[model samples]
Target: LVTIVAVNQTGGDIPLSQLYAPNSKIPASGSANLTDYNRVEEILGDTSDLGRGATLEYHPDPNLLVAKTKDAPSATLDCSVGVVAGGTSDIPIAEEARIIAAESGLDVVRAYDVGVAGLHRLFPPLKEMILRDVDLLIVVAGMEGALPSVVKGLIDVPVIGVPTSVGYGYRGGESALIAMLNSCVPGLLVTNIDNGFGAAAAAYAICSRMMKKREE
Candidate 1:
């Protein structure tokens, strides 16, 4: 919720949206372009409110831009975050969010390879996650972006949806983003395309508030 950075896709027909796309020996590198720099400049243009929103970082090898939100939560409450990936291709972003949640001192429980391709696969691990009683669940998906809504319907915990750039002709998460945005499930939280960090940040903020209320 702090900063916004805009960047354009490089390809014409099948864009190299994600570095880990199928048959995508496409992206040569993850270099930041002028537009990226300019976007950063625009976000950092005014330092009116400092250290409140987010911090931006770039991954060089695969060339990803990530913004992580940080804040320390209470040590007393045994806070935990559950992260689920719709498919194997979405693991990197899921792991990134999990790492951030762990760094913020929340125990992270993860289940992978449970995408909506097979509905039967999601239940066992999902039951385990719910049994653990996590403070929040961060669901990462691409394609039709149906995982988050499914998770939300099954659980009462806060659900954060991350739409990755994994679908065909979805334009690097466009379809997934739209799916998440249009989700009829009430109270389902969502992040931008491939934005795992934002989900983690939102998770941290929510968990912290809950912990504070518990203390109060």
Candidate 2:
């Protein structure tokens, strides 16, 4: 049982006090704002009552949830890919890439905080990933943007470089993006600065083509 909470940004967290039945003083005819509606906890009871285990899926909007789930199964079997982030600051961009790939019906393996500053940290998993034959790789980095180049040198597979906007001072993210764009190695592709979603989309397209060729 997963409890998912979706709240309107403008409407603050609902207070516990306003959940009761309105009396004459409060006027039951008054508009009930979602902002005023406080805490909601779903109590999942034992499955014995219904002859099955309790697996309650709650959606804030029932119609949208139903439509989404109906298409989810068929949409989830398209591609297998890997996402490697250079550092902790790059995790958000990496996560965004993972989310985009997953939503596009791809399986994603996340390798995080393995930047080029610590060269030894990147080799083992990278070698293993290359051996396992991931269809495509998304290399996410910020500062120097050297991870993609290193990985490109190590493997023959296509690598898409993602430069995050996490650098400081005069260098800004432009320095990292330029570094990636200027990579001397071959088979290294690049997206705009901090464009994780775009990088993931490009990887998905590449994997999809590979899958199609495999099927043929």
Residue-wise C-alpha lDDT for candidate 1, range 51-115, written one tens digit per residue: 33434555432233443333312222357899999998888788767755654556899998898
TM-score list, all predictions = 0.66, 0.65
lDDT of all the models against the reference? 0.66, 0.61
- Across 1-216, the per-residue lDDT of candidate 2 in tens digits comes to 111212111122211123323110111222121111122231223223212122223233211111121112224445567899998888877876775565455777778888977888887888778777777789999887888998889888888999888856136578778888999999999998877757866876676666678779
Measured by TM-score, the strongest candidate is: 1
| Model 1 misplaced stretches (Cα beyond 4 Å) | 1-77
TM-score of 2: 0.65
Looking at model 1, the pairs that clash are 30-63, 86-115
The window of 10 residues in a row where model 2 has the poorest summed lDDT is 62-71
The residue ranges of model 2 lying beyond 4 angstroms of the native Cα positions read 1-67, 169-171
Error of 2 at 38 (Å): 21
